[model samples]
Target: MNTTANHTSPPAPRVSKTRRRLPVLILAALLAAVPAHHALADKNDHIEARELLKRGEIVPLARILEVVQQRVPGDVIEVELEREDGLWEYKVKVLTPTGRVRKLYLDARNGVVLKIKDD
Candidate 1:
């Protein structure tokens, strides 16, 4: 009988504990962050018009009265926007530049002077 050389198979490659756990941990973290991001985006997306009005975008009543006093050179006792008969208009009651109580109507769309009554 002839003696033959014995061949042995190589061992399987080893996987580190850290490498196996890291990917699963990272995937779990990413999934958790997704819903939190969506909730934040939804909360900030829309605002109401009434809420906007309170936040100083629309003209303030005090400032409008001040402008009337400066331009007309008299005390503006009252200012209001009212629907008159069937029309929407700004009704401004002022102690005029001439020291008379005057009522004026301004066109809402263009701010053009419409009518003036001094009393």
Candidate 2:
């Protein structure tokens, strides 16, 4: 009878609980920061818009709505202030008496109607 010894490699080192949780904790932190960053950005946008209005760079919504009403007699539904091609514009949507919606693009600085489209 021959005596043979079975040689097995030692088990790998066990990972600590903190080491396992490091990646998860980092991911959670990154996810939490995303919404906070967005909130700060939204607040900054409001501040910039207010500054523009105060500086007369962009006209007020009330004035823009008045101009829109004269051209399209409808219930004002929605309005959005957007910047395009380095120019500020007001995109206005109106629901007309004929049950049709019209989208109006206007120059935000002076409330000049730039284009109107039926929707």
Among the numbered candidates, top TM-score falls to 2
**For residue 21, what is the lDDT in candidate 1?**
41
lDDT for each candidate structure: 0.48, 0.70
Give candidate 2's TM-score.
0.63
TM-score for each candidate, following the candidate numbering:
0.40, 0.63
Q: Name every residue pair that clashes in candidate 1.
A: none
Q: Which 10 successive residues of model 2 have the least lDDT summed?
A: 28-37
Candidate 1 per-residue lDDT, tens place, 1-119, comes to 86987889899888775465455434322221122224323332223212323563334333444445555665555554443555434556766546778877664334456777775
Model 1: residues >4 Å from true position, as ranges?
1-67
Model 2, range 1-119, lDDT digits (tens) per residue? 76888889999999975576455434322222122124333434655666778899988766887898899986766666667777878777788889999999899899999999997
- All candidates: CA RMSD (Å): 28.8, 18.9
**Alpha-carbon shift of residue 5 in model 2 (angstroms):** 98
- lDDT at position 119, candidate 2: 73
